[model samples]
Target: MFDSLQDKMESAFKNLKGEGKLTEINVAQSIKEIRRALVAADVNYKIAKEFTDKIKDEALGSKNILKSVKPGELMVKIVMDEMTTLMGGQATGINVKGNPGVVLVAGLQGSGKTTFSGKLALFLKEKKSMKPLLVACDVYRPAAIDQLTVLAEQIGAAVYKEPENKNPVSIAQNAIAYAKGHSHDVVIVDTAGRLAIDEVMMTEIRNIKSGINPTETLFVVDSMTGQDAVNTALAFNDVIDYDGVVLTKLDGDTRGGAALSVKYTVGKPIKFASTGEKLNTLDVFHPERMAQRILGMGDIVSFVEKAQDQFDEEEAKRLEKKIKRNKFDYNDFLQQVNQIKKMGDLKSLMGMIPGMGKAIKDIDINDGAFSKVESIIYSMTEDERLKPEILNMSRKRRIAMGCGHNIHEINMFVKQFEQMRKMMTQMSKGKGMERMMQQMQQKR
Candidate 1:
């Protein structure tokens, strides 16, 4: 997401690439480039200057102390630390620790407030094992309740809305009561938002917060808005004093100034970040990992966390047994694909690996790639999928016609599937393989 900023920061660090040590001349040159990069990303000019000034001091202070470290490496470390501090030093957990925790969400219109509510509901329900109820309080917008209802249904969460009540504060208060009596452990009240910050919107949200006394109040903003997002956060905080910030549309934010600057400007932690439209695409904002990603170092910790989140231990055992018996067929392959899909977008996930973001930055990797492969497998008959070896030339032609693909494409897929099965079968029985399986099982 910080692609442009990463590129610029890399260029800045290149100034010290061949320098044996961090000198004032080289450090100042690099700092100047870094300052320009931040300003170009829409960060406040004063904050950018102050940030680079700190980097200069740190670099100069470390020049003689760390002679073993390369100047470029030392500069990267300095910038990463300062960036982390700018973005709230560490991850902050949402306060959901009440009888029925009440979370009041506020933001501008089209800031993805509703979408984030649904994602948060799903996240709390699945990850934290909390029964979350999504409350629709956007009474002004047409069909806002319906939109929230659809999202809640998709996530298997209950929606509490008073379509006729009109008063958001009343709707929020009633929703919390309903949640308490209905076993919903968390109540997320999605308040109304305006196209821009205005008194009416602020007053309504402030009243709702005063009425419900939410355990946690969050202000969601479109990260694509750049510095405006930070200014909006300040306005919301002045009235509602939100506990944290939520940065939405982060995947589309190539410069990522909002994420880097909001916390610094508003004095609040970025609680969550919404990358894509998928409900599962919401992530708890981790400043350290984000700094690592922005520095082109990748975020392996987050990558593994996503993997473990989607991992099914019992299912893995079943698949391992099948592979050991050379029975890893189309069905198993399809199931594995679905599991990966659950882990979020392929390109974004791959970017989490160390050094992979730069490698595939220009590549277009999407779900459509797997969809083509899935369509071919879906066209196969039960027997053919279970035992692909039984497919003759006539059967192949029929399968190709079914999936709207050519015979050559079908043949290529079959060959790849066979190769995968053989390799998995060999690995399933290799030395220390059982130990690896046990370790995976233990994680569950």
Candidate 2:
């Protein structure tokens, strides 16, 4: 998401290279470049200036304190610290601690307000084990209610909607009472959004907040809007005085000015970030991890957390036994792909690994590749899937016709599968890694 900004920041740090220690001239040059980069990313000019000025002061102050550390490295550390503080130093949790916690969501139309409501419901239901009731208070649009209903159905959460009622305040209050009666611990009130900020919209949302007295009020903003997002957030905060901000559409936000400037401008922490359209793509905002990401240092902590979330201890044991016996077949391969799909988008997941983001920046890797393999595997018979070795020339041609692919594609897939199985078996035996490295070196 911060691809351009990352590149510019790297260039700024490179300007300090070959310098023994931080100097006024070198620090000023780097600071000017950093400020330009931030401004080009759509960050407010004043905010960028202040942010980089702080970095410059820190750099000059620490010149002799850490003589052994490289100037470029020290400058990076200083900028990272300032950026973290600007984005709200640590993560902030949503306030859902009431008997029936009410979280009122307000945003502009098409800001992904309803989608985020669904994601938040799913996150709470699956991760927090909370019974979240999705309240469709966006009574202005009939489609809004239907959207929430569909999302709730998919997430396995209850939806409280009064389609006939046009009063959002009444609907929100009623929904909270319904939550209390249904034993739902959390009530997420999805308020109506307008195409632009207007008095009517602002008053309606403020009234809803006052009527429900929600434990947390979040303003959902589209990060793709750049500085406009910051302005909208501030306007909303002035009226509703929201507890936190939810930045959506971050996967499409290349500049990332909203994430970097929202907290500093609106005086609210970005509690969560919604990336892709997937219901499982919502993540709690971590400023330090984000800073590391912007500086080309991948967020390994977040990467591991996602892996642990998708990890199945019992499934791991079963897969380990199968791999040890060389019994991993197409079915197991398909299952593994499905599990990885649940982890999030393939490209974004790779970006979380150290140095992998830049390595695959221009690569077009998508789930479609996995889907092709799945189609091939699904075309196979039960016996063939269990024992891929049974597939001969006739069997491959038949499978190719079944999956609508060429016989050559089938042959290549089968050969790759066999090689993968052999490699995995050797690794399980603790002898393949060294031999594999030797073979790789020889090929090089």
Candidate 3:
């Protein structure tokens, strides 16, 4: 995610931790580095200065304090606090409380507005048990409606679109009416985006707002736009006065500017973050977790919550039992891959573990990593998946040709799978080892 910023922040904190006593010169040096790192991360110059200035003050004021805790640890606490404050300090979730609650989606072109809308609808429908109706308000783009429809279908959410009606306001209004009639509890109107802040775009969104009177208006901005995202968010907030901001494209090589400064700049809390194109890749914005992530520490709580959401409990229990019985095989491996996919992209999953993000930062990880294993598993018959030991040299040769892979590659995957199976088996059979492993992965 913000790997560079994380590294720099950790380095800055390192200046304090190893020192026996905090000194004015060393603290000032660390603060300077911290400011530079924030600037490099695309944070607004003014905000970055103010943030570091706060850290410097805190470091100096609390000098020679907390004898048991290192100066660096205390500095980390200060930086974490200031970083969290800059990013809204607290997690403010979307307000979808009204009967037939309304959520208005607004953003620029290619900001993933439509996808976020669908994700939000599905989130409310599946997570909150609310019947959601997705209203397509982007009448200008011919494919916008279809894109929303495809996403809605994938998530099993209902859609309300009018290709014949060019007016988004009327469509949104009528969709709410339809939702009311059908007992739908949530109506999310997905509006159009502009290349920039234009008069026509603002006017159209304002008209839609006036007509539907949404319970929550979300301004979706692409985090990859860097400081430009903060500027655009300001413009949007000035026009529609949105309830919250939704930062999209966080999965990209975003410099962390928008996330770190948008709320402070626009004076609106970021309610959600869209990490990927997948419908289940949305996460409620949390300032503390984000600050921890920016500081190079992993977010295990959010990661486990994501696993809980995407992984089936019954299936996980079954796999755990299989591991305990030493029956974890290619079938279990395939199931685990599916479970990971259900969570989101491969890189995003790796990022959940603290140090894995740094380790895999430059690695070209993709679904291709799973391809050879999947191919080998598919090459095997059902019985082989159940019992992998049956594949001797001759059997492995036949399986290799069937999957169009060399024997070496198949053997490599099989070896990794075997190692993982053994590890899982040992952990499951040991007393309270699985929890410890989970904690270790969470820390990593």
Pairs clashing within candidate 3: 16-72, 17-72, 354-444, 355-444
Best-fitting candidate, scored by TM-score: 1
TM-score of 3: 0.93
Overall local distance difference test of candidate 1: 0.90
lDDT of 3 by residue, 1-444 (tens): 888888888888777766886689889989999999999989988999999999988888887677777888888888999999989989997788776899999999988899899889878877799988999999987699999999889989899988999999999989999998999989999999877789999999999999988899999989999899999889888889999999888988888999999988989999998887778878889999999888877788888877766555456667677788898888778877877777777787777787788888899887577787788899998888889888788888989999999999878877887898888788787755568545545554
TM-scores for every candidate against the unseen true structure: 0.97, 0.95, 0.93
How many steric overlaps does candidate 2 have? 0
Query: Candidate 2's residue-wise lDDT over 1-444, tens digit each?
Result: 788998899999998899988999999999999999999999999999899989988999999999999999999999999999999999999999898988999999989999999999999998899999999888887588999999999989999988788888888888888888889999998988998999999999889988999999999999999999899999999999999999998777469789899999998999998888889999999999999998888888887778778766667667777888899999999988888888887888889888988888788887575888998999999999999889999999999999999999999999999999998987977855446444434443
Per-residue lDDT of model 1, residues 203-279, tens digit only: 88889999999999999989999999899899889998899999998778558789889988999999998888899
For each candidate in the order shown, give its overall lDDT on alpha carbons.
0.90, 0.90, 0.86
RMSD of each: 1.4, 4.5, 2.8
Among all windows of ten consecutive residues in candidate 2, which has the lowest summed lDDT? 435-444
* Span of 10 residues, lowest total lDDT, candidate 3: 435-444
Regions of model 2 farther than 4 Å from truth:
431-444
Model 3 CA deviation exceeding 4 Å by range? 311-313, 432-444
| TM-score of candidate 2 relative to the true fold | 0.95
**Candidate 1 backbone clash number:** 0
